[model samples]
Target chain A: MEDVYMGIDVGSISTKGVIITKENKILSSEYIWTEGNPIGAVKKLVRLLEKQFDKENYRIVATGTTGSARKLVGTVLSATVVKNEITAHAVGTTTFHPDVRTILEIGGQDSKIILVENGVAVDYAMNTLCAAGTGAFLSSQSARLGIPVEDMGEIAVKSQHPTQIAARCTVFAESDLVHKIQVGHTKEDIVAGLCQAVVGNYLNNVGKGKKIQSPVVFQGGVSKNIGVVKAFENQLGCPIIVDPDGHLMGAIGAAILARRNKERRVFNFDVEDMEFITREINCGGCPNNCEIICVYRNGEMIDSWGNRCERGDVAARKAANPNAAAV
Target chain B: MDEIRMPKAEYNHHEMVVGIPRSLLYFRYGVLWERFFQELGVKTITSAPTNLKIMTNGSRRAASEMCLAMKIYMGHVESLIGKCDYILVPRILDFGLRRVMCVNFEALPDVVSNIFFESPIRVLSYNIDVSKKLDERRAMVEMAVSMGFSHGKSNKAYKKARKAQNEADSRAVKQNEAKYKNDGITLVLAGHSYILEDEYIGKPIMQYLNENGVNVVRADLVDRKAALRESERLSPTLKWELSREIVGSLVMHVHDFDGVVLLSVYPCALDSMVNDMMLRKNRITHVPILQMTLDAQTGTAGVETRLESFLDILKMRKEVEAGNGREAEA
Candidate 1:
């Protein structure tokens, strides 16, 4: 049977899954909202992919997970590789566009800029302590403007002149947006202005000090917005390449990582029915009060972490399995 | 009859325990203080390392605009309340002109006192304002004298403590020098000692790097005299004492490190300006730089991602130079 790989990206806003062959060809893909429930989201995502995947023609040999909740989802899927989103995104993007020198990503609550040299990420930075110039910022503004986030991109591109708004912070942006609306700026212009603000904030914050070379690729959830894409293009004075599968790049990268990993394990869609429960406990064994997270599979303790000392480890294990002998 | 023979009650110096907050200048002078007290036959207690409860208490007590370091310091001070006889809060204004510390250091004692004015916690302090010709040894001696120690005894204890502190510092500097001989990816972690040594903020980053097989070098662990000289030559106008030391270390060891990680706490004006200047003035062509500004809300995941990607970049670069760039994918 042909060897295949599975990858899942469980992010704060969305869950994505993909099946790919050794040659990096996508056999099947699925994307859905996480809706604050990562386990349920992955189960739904995997089931969707299972329907599209050709099980008879290919055998899934490896699996990988990426994004914020990668560890939780990795355990759920028994992934062979659990990589961070930055490395995953870089690998995924470089695989497709080997010559790409810059990768700009704007996701739900975060944004990052990665500078690539010869297909390797040399330097990078992420938006710190603020969600000012991310997809979440746009969605919130979209709500205030009585316009859907998906529609804002279309409306933005139609503006003749985009009004300037303070993009230093979300609070400042919100007040400036309200002031502009009170002064009667057109909806399209305001929407376009918001997109510009995001680009400006991103550059001033995450993209600060980094050299932005040519062959730039923009991805993540925000890449779907044409308005922001145009804003990036205008600001950087270079053509921004947005792949059709840009949003799935994280999951695709994960799949590539699984393919590259030396370890091999048979991955099956049967995980859709496995009961995965995550329990967070404030371990009081020490003053650190580490919030240990334990993942239980079918009422059996699978894995646990976040304890600083052996006392915490024992406490977590004891909390999960009281009947088991103490270590 | 045996109890009746124990007629004379001797005065115990160990009863007056001085509580030292494990933050700010403690990282700089902790050994000195501990050794001084030990030499004087007095007992001392240091507040525990930064933890969730301490950080939360500090953030609640400090002003909204204060840097995270300051807030955490306040929390450490709060943790020592009622735990010891007196809490030590030193007003370290400056070592000398152009070697001045952050203004927060000058106000730390007063800030702690004012924040806990209603509480029954009494603050014990020493002044290190060199502009007024006051020095650390003299201040420490006077503090000890006020605590009922003889002038000569306090002076001798201070000298011994200073010597002990110097030896410990030299050991650290030597350890850093020895790490340079190791054949691996050496990254210079540049930050204030308070930020780098804190158990809550910096330890995990160091732990992660150590686990990943990277040779970690601390920028602040260099010889202060050498570092100061390098700092003066690099940036004559640079004023802050700690910033000068950091700049000097970075300048002196720039060639040895494969990469530099500029770690700073959130909203620290000194670090913000110093780091920006360093980034702009950095002339090294090959060394990759990563700036991580952490705050109360910073999670380990974000930091891990950055660090992992950084290691990848270094590995990929090394592979490319060796004509085996393909192995970077593994």
Candidate 2:
């Protein structure tokens, strides 16, 4: 039987799953909206991927998880390899594109620029505080412009003269874009300007104090935008490569990481009949009353988080064993 | 009609109890702390001394950017919240005697209040600025008056507390002096002794180094005159007494030690910036320097590894220099 590895990228916006053969061929993949429920999304993703591939043909060996929801998913799935997004992204991109020197990733909420030296990530910067150069920003702007988000790239391509928008911050860029539109700039010109502003903002904020060299691989959801890709190439004076499976790179990275780990664990992909429930509680430990989230399986509290103390741990343990004395 | 009875003014008679976290100013003014409340006829409850549990608790609640001391202090405060009626978290802006703590220290009460807004425990605070003739006595008197004590009684309490605090501080200074004179690689640790004394946060690092045969010296252990003079050499314009003392101690003893370890708490904006500047400007090329940031969640494993690596680097440099000297002689 052929061996298969499982990779899960449990992000805030979406949860992605990928099943790969021993030789790293993508056998089955699925993406599902998280909808603020990471556990539910992972369960759905696992069920979807399992349906596409025959369990008999490929024996599951190892599992890896990445992204913001990586820990939650990993805990739920019992993943063999749990890694940060940086390591997973670098591993995934480098495996496919060995000669790639840089990776520019702009996701739904965050943007990051990873500098690779001989396929190793030497330095990387992530913009977690701002939302200026992200997919959410673009989608909101597209809605404001009365254009479908999917049509933004194609419309931007039609501009004869693109207007220059401020790319300092989201507030500044929005006002600048609105001002440019008010001054009677064409919709296409404004769209093109918006694309340019995103690239500029990313380069200035996330890509600050770092050298961004080419053979750059632009991945993440925003990489689907040809307008943004063209802006990156124009600004950096270098060709940008966007993988056809760029949206699934994090998942792909996770898959590759799972394969690399020698530990083999049999994964029971039979998630169809699994019962899971989530509950939220407030921990009044100190002045910071942290709202804790607890996940239960078969009426047994499996995991709890959100509280910044041992309170969560005690609560989870107590919930699991009702007779246990409270700490 | 029944006659209503009010609460008695005697300290022993009072049912209301105040809790004090002995982490930050607790180190600086423990005697004054106990004395002031005692004189005011109020019961004071202090959190247990710094321990592993407190450190772990603090680290979990504090943000990633907060300094180790603040994190530990928060932990201490957390321990006292439910156990006491009110936590005495004074906001000492300035000493009025040219000594001012970091802005973070000044804003600690506000930070604690904001961080623990949901907690039922009340926080009692008083602002002190000696530069504006706002001395400790005046501050204590004001605190007492606010708590419903009469002006004459508050004044008496303040004087008594002040006297007790001075004696305690002097005794602590003497003990530290004795501890400083021991044999081995004498390191003059330059931060607040309170931070250095915390068992879980700062003390373990010192204990580890000492157990490895390196003698520990505290910046707080040195004579005030000598440390001040040494600080003048490093930076003539250095103002804060504690910082100046540390810098002075480093300058004076940099040649005597093999290496220097500068320990700072996380989110300490003043120390982070000033200490980095000191490390850059100092011309002590022969000695190695290690800057460690302490937070509530400081893993002993990581710190141990760093300390081991730093020590190895110094050892390697020494061996190389010694070999070079022998080769030149031959």
- Measured with C-alpha atoms, the lDDT of residue A164 in candidate 2 is 92
TM-score of chain B of each: 0.92, 0.81
lDDT of 2 by residue, B37-114 (tens): 888788999998776667768777776677777777888989997787777888777653445677776777778877
Which clashing pairs does model 1 show? Answer: none
- Sequence-dependent TM-score of model 2: 0.60
lDDT of 2 by residue, A35-124 (tens): 898888898898899889887777788899988777668778878887667667877887788888889999887787776665555445
**In candidate 2 chain B, where is summed lDDT lowest over 10 consecutive residues?**
B1-10
- What is residue A116's positional error in candidate 1, in angstroms? 1.5
List model 1 lDDT by residue over B36-155, tens digit each: 989999888999999878998999999999999999998988888888766888888888868989999888777888888787676778788887787999988877776678999999
Candidate 1 stretches greater than 4 Å from native: A325-327, B1-15, B145-150, B283-286, B328-330
The positional error of residue A323 in candidate 1, measured at the CA in angstroms, is 2.4
